[model samples]
Target chain A: MERVLFKPLSQVAICGGTHGNELCGVYMLKELPRDRSGTFSLTTVLANPRAVDTCQRFTEKDLNRCFTDTLLSDLLTEDSPYEVRRAQELNALLGPKGSEATMDLVCDLHSTTSNMAICIITHLNDRVGQHLFKYMREKIRSAPVRLILLTSPLSEGYSLDCLGKHSCTIEVGPQPHGVLRADVYNQMREAVDRMLEWIESFNSGTVFEGGEVEGYSMVEKKDYPRDPETQELTAVIHPQLQDNDFCLLKPGDPVFMTFSGETIHYEGDELYPFFVNEGAYYEKNTAFVLGQKQSLLVPSISVEKEQ
Target chain B: MERVLFKPLSQVAICGGTHGNELCGVYMLKELPRDRSGTFSLTTVLANPRAVDTCQRFTEKDLNRCFTDTLLSDLLTEDSPYEVRRAQELNALLGPKGSEATMDLVCDLHSTTSNMAICIITHLNDRVGQHLFKYMREKIRSAPVRLILLTSPLSEGYSLDCLGKHSCTIEVGPQPHGVLRADVYNQMREAVDRMLEWIESFNSGTVFEGGEVEGYSMVEKKDYPRDPETQELTAVIHPQLQDNDFCLLKPGDPVFMTFSGETIHYEGDELYPFFVNEGAYYEKNTAFVLGQKQSLLVPSISVEKEQ
Candidate 1:
């Protein structure tokens, strides 16, 4: 059996296949040579084995959603026939015992409900996080990717969020059933390569000067609770994203709005035009795409990554 | 043996003995009759039997953190073990199975690390959430409650934030060897009674027109990652709230600040003296809670909750 070998001094631990259906990262890892050749070793763990076998997002539970210290420990001990054991196995590998080697960076690859482009999910206040965010903007500014949603600290408690540091979830577009799409796979590959390059540069004494980090306007996750009586869509309007017309918006901005006209307004000083697609406004597929109507007219900022 | 009763019409579920050592809620539930027979019925579940038997917080996992959909399902499955079986049994009694029987309130009473007063945990959104926040403010107006740190929606995925609605974790402080102090217990009792009354008023078509609903300065969770190498506390300072005088910070002001000193100041248009605590300016805690320093004198503005 070929084993996944990582670089001894690798500071980052990038994992995909956390949710079995989100396999773009897994395929990318599979394509890489088994040995990293000491160029900052990369170890890839296919998180949920059973789920992967079934080509399902998860077997019993959303593994990404169950990363709290308590839940992780429980899965480690409990005896059951489920994918949690896979999660436990991966956790042990990632969080090795008595090893001072803590991951300085973690990128959990995922796919959203919409066919959006690449996005880097990081905490706003992290220097390294900001550095990576800036680097992505510089590298992939021309992609169909629109706005990078800054998840309010309150709404971030998942795998990357639970990691409690410069961990981010690089969201590719929505999953394509059991098979990986060519575009998404390529995009994931490119993103991983770029991230690895950035890590190498940082380790080799390259300076990552920070840039003007953009704050995300409130993008509320709309919940459509089925009506108990009718079992029909009750049209629950959760106005999570406050539309800021002053900030420059692009064509593919991820807008969270209710079918109703209730919209959240951006309070920042700048005003930008709003973008909209009339037909795909309400469906989950269209609603989750990242786009913007106005373009940020702010001065170009530079970010430096240091070793 | 007293049978555990399940009630759904009542929008309340009282679970005690989650932490075996701090079994105040357990004893309290036992002291009360099986059925309180109030407008809101109460269904009590003993979260961990093994933990309770061993007198510990948990046997293998912290029960409070194991409230995800998957874990709940695992607990409900027939072949599950002790805690999982108990969880299943409890779910049959209290899970969000029946549409009409969905629980609107869950009071997870817990003891904390300090000797502070009672702390109510609720999302900054939901009307009931606001009601609880206001109730706590009214209950301990002048008491040395230290600080009412609003757990960002990003902290606990099982919290009201993930519920995408409203829920609170009431931390009754000064746990004496994993047990609640007498005063803390009294405070919990009073707070629960008041909260119940508020809920009753809400159910009877009586709106809680207590006062103006305060706006929350939203903070992202990822921005506050603990440094991997230094292990030092870190957070993204929302650009809006940096370096500005915090004027007119009432018990319920939603102050939002970014690491870059940008301040998003919003309060009902009233010019009030903002207070600041310079000594308590540590990470995780509020920037204004350090010590008494020069407070901000700013013109207050009136803002309403975005419906």
Candidate 2:
């Protein structure tokens, strides 16, 4: 095999089972061949090792929520919770405060119980990220790819993806915690390989060329209807909307079904609902998030120019 | 609709999540219509309410293991672990120990990460249990049904199934904890409904006519190949055996493949493997269990004859 030599690039893959029950990402990172020859330097990490070992969501706090700026500095204590200290260690490894990131790009792998497609979560302002998303949408035909830009203010510095200059978190689902499906595993493995190949192509001066991406922009998270007194869930995902995630939810469409067999129609304007009935979000009472579809413009990206 | 009527029978279904992460049984029981008219009186109880709420396998000790005779004695105290106390409560509710079982039948629902199909686990001597298993095996065609006899000496009086005179726990899988698959859930629902219908027929003087049930009798558990020093898994299920669960593993068949691409052949006789790579059994270092095929004799079971 002829080696393709190109400009040096440093990329890292940060995978979390930090919620611990998510086994797809953990196993993917663990099973990845440690050493692979490529133009770009690649490093793989298990973001929450302890949680992965225990196969729980987290030991004390949700590790995904511990990456805020305040929690990063001066709050470090010897007796701090596992996730807080792990976040600080991750910061130093992937991103040191007030310093250039050691990694040029980060790929965080995640799995969910929602019927959402393979999602590429990146900031709206990231040009390179958008181009990569378009590439993956075309390159990985086994699974559909969607781009979701986090619009919440609190999401700014709270996730592992924010630790790098350019990052794309891959979310695949309709799977539960601690279970690995061969089909799902194969899809995820192919994704990691495709991602690495894309990075290699980028460093080797090959543009992703032309492609179109259809994605949803973050709008709002809608919680399930609950009773005021006991706060018990009063309704479930309506039969029409159940497993029909990412479909248009126009006004008058059945969105919820009350325990008493009454259907609640969507009262809002047309939008697409994703993350329908996600198991992890049950504690937060979230039924799903509604988003509006928009065509994403993919800008040409060059690795050497960025470097 | 003509309703079948006959001798009255009290049958209680004890669904365990008592460890809580197993949601199939919990949801099946919860979603089952509260009032169904039948000859057999039905009562359903969530074995481990607290564990079910937390979606964990268990809060303290394994709830299934805490049902031993010693733990059921007067030694249980307020300071005892959560499951120990929970076991005592269940005893009063289901068994009221050292007396006749409070219920005629129990159906403990369980899920596993293994590729095992719908399994009916019961003691070897239960004539009525075998009849029900044979009926389910023939009726529930969506998934194959297997009968597993808990031949272990310690298996007696240590599980919720022991709380009833005629009980067979339904084990369905290849699902993760806290997640529910529509297919798996539907299968379980149908099984529960079928079991109830079978019980009704038995009580109404209808004999489950004829069916030969090909079942695998428990032989032994086989663990994965692990590193002698660090005890890390050194190989994965071989390609030949992956998803080939419940098939006979003849001598010299491929069973595992080492990380270095070496094949480790199976040296055992023609025994069948089930529960391959079950997530819960990882703690026990169990890869799967080997069983020998045997024709289970279905005895004509009538409620009046048993009484």
Candidate 3:
């Protein structure tokens, strides 16, 4: 277990209400106390406040998808989307992303209608993210946890998590918008706490060992079958696939069932699926994303000694 | 069996999309072919077209609840609610409330997030409604079926179903708003077909048996536990009660669980609960409605022979 020496994580942020309708995160923010410890600084943000007020995911544009470097630095006019301006403000606050002055880590919270139990998503090839996901999977005991690595570069990353130097998103689900479950709320609370604890342990001189970690790397997305003429959906998620996220999907397996009582089978290559049958993704026509199994050997690291 | 007779049902209307996000009916309307037969004329309505287009429950006000006589006859200024005008227009087409020219029967379609399987909601004291529900229960074997009797006067009815001479609402659920499932859509389709079949049978002089029918009569509503200071929800539906609609809720049974993981038990009299934990009802602060089991002996009836 060779350790790679690095600077201690001194600046951390926890954000929620990125999607106003997702209540687990929105309410979790209210319960989190502001913290300013001697070792590190903590910032908690309520993202997309107007959307939360109306219980709408977003007013004009989705705030979660507004954090790309291009969008963050873009000039804002009076007619600019509300989320774009909000993203810029966020950049000024915790990000100005890709800069050395940026926050050490940002943990964005989300909830999905899809039965993705507990998903920790991070940027691929980031050694810090890999170590963090491994820690989360080990510490989170109440629910099944899985990590997804996005291959997109940080500058091209669209989610709010990509705004920090080191970042990840915690998505808990089988929960609906504007609705909360005690189990889900508990899951969210524990995740945030565990994340904070990990940061504290790292800053206190605990070394993270290098190891091969297992996760999913997305290959492509699958959209719902729709009527070509009307563009209306012709089928829905198959009974076999619904609520069975992260299951390996094989060719010729039932993926959808048409309104006419016909089963639509999967013809694509075998892959593990996540984000299955999300209600929010209905607007985007995405049924789910297919992923290939991945194993990454993360680098071991430690906080750099002060001075 | 001797039977009281009425005129044959010649004109019937089936309406969908009264609340547009409920997609079971919206798509069902598209699937129905126009019928202009010798025995009966079938008219299928896509109610609230604008709402359906936007995939919202309603643009301003709920269209399903906008069909009361007061709203239908109210003076329509340019500033009136869109649903009000639409209700008036529907009244002119299929109704002029309490008039002999009203449609013979109206089957308004609905879907809910609550696990109320196949709910046939009708006006209390209507023999036609009782007979229809009895018939639907026997015919629809793919799902569980239940009937709810509204105690309100027809004139005071707040739903689109009240616009006809004999009307009932076919509510199927646990379906999310804006998301359609093959199972739910199939249930909706079957319910509509059976209702129309019953209508034709009654019109052709089939005798509906006099018998005791069991159903639910709503007694009161229960709102979610909320923070007294902020009015934000403090607890969510307990896991035991979630998706357990139409179940006996006894005193001391867990109904809610606070975010802090404390169980909130039911303190009221024993009753059956339905429409439990509906997301749409979140806006109204209604967690669920309690009902008392009811038994009504409906009289045998037959369509009066012409002349």
Best-fitting candidate, scored by lDDT: 3
Deviation (Å) of A238 in candidate 3: 2.4
Instruction: State the weakest 10-residue window (summed lDDT) of model 3 chain B.
Output: B30-39
TM-score of the A chain in candidate 1? Answer: 0.67
Please, what is the TM-score per model? 0.38, 0.83, 0.95
User: Model 3, DockQ value?
Assistant: 0.53
Runs in model 1 with CA error above 4 Å? A1-9, A75-83, A96-100, A145-156, A160-165, A215-219, A234-307, B1-307
Checking candidate 2 for backbone clashes, the offending pairs are A17-A20, A19-A57, B17-B20, B18-B48, B19-B57
Candidate 3 C-alpha lDDT tens digits along B1-307:
5577768878888999999889899888877767545468988898899999987889999888888877987999999989889999999988987799998888899998788989999989667887899998877889998999999877788888888888889999877777776677788889888887888888877888877789999999999999899898888899888888888999999999887778999999989999888888888878999999999877788888897
Which of candidates 2 and 3 is the stronger one according to lDDT? Answer: 3
**lDDT for each residue of candidate 3 in A45-118, tens digit (9 for 90 to 100):** 99889999988889899998888877887888999999999999988898788888888888898998788878
Model 2, A86-125: lDDT tens digits are 9899888887633565466777888887767688887776
Tell me the TM-score of model 3: 0.95
By DockQ, rank the candidates, best first: 3, 2, 1
Give the C-alpha miss distance for residue B133 in model 2, angstroms: 2.8
Displacement of residue B18 (Cα, Å) in model 3 is: 1.2
- On TM-score, the candidate that comes out on top is 3
lDDT of 1 by residue, A177-245 (tens): 333434455566677777777767666655555335553434433323344795433222222222222
DockQ of candidates 1 onward, in order?
0.01, 0.24, 0.53
